[model samples]
Target: MFAARRFVLAARSAASIGSKRAVHKGIEGTPPMRYMSVAERIAVYGLITVSFLSYPTYLMINLDNIRPKGENSLGDNALAEKERRAAVRA
Candidate 1:
């Protein structure tokens, strides 16, 4: 019984990791945030501003959407993209 439980837990963790990897791959095809159009950036920033201002109260009310994506890969891509651009310019 204990071994079965451990197996299930390990399987669950592996599945979560797989999903995060899938999300990361999907993000890689997109242009980084800085390269996005002004309207897109403004919309993103507006939502971020509103989300920050709302804080815990908004999170509590909208638990589903507020949940973080597995690895939040966009931030990683932003830095990577910046470095790539700088390297090209140099």
Candidate 2:
């Protein structure tokens, strides 16, 4: 209860005091936003295209690593059949 009263008094005292600094005169002192130039636009577009296409490009590059070690081709079911036959023979 004492702490709460002290906190309220502090807040009231703080609220009564005014800041020494004045408020900012917004935008009047600053430059206005403008449209991008052709070169700037091209660079921005190029960056965006690179970011979006990078994942697919990386996946395409490392596609061979996605398959099983001996299965270089997608249709190489024969390799698995041979492995199974070898295991049975063993």
Q: In terms of lDDT, which candidate is strongest? A: 1
Clashing pairs for predicted structure model 1, backbone only: none
Question: For candidate 1, lDDT tens digit of each residue in 1-90?
Answer: 999999999999999999977886656667699479999999999999888888778768899787776865568789999999999999
Candidate models: Cα lDDT each: 0.86, 0.76
Query: Considering only N, C-alpha and C atoms within 3 Å, which residue pairs clash in candidate 2?
Result: none
Stretches off by above 4 angstroms in model 2 are 1-33, 70-90
- TM-score of each model, paired residue for residue: 0.30, 0.38
- CA displacement after TM-score superposition, residue 36 of candidate 2 (Å): 1.6
* Residue ranges of candidate 1 with Cα displaced over 4 Å: 26-90
Q: Which ten residues in a row have the lowest lDDT in candidate 2?
A: 18-27
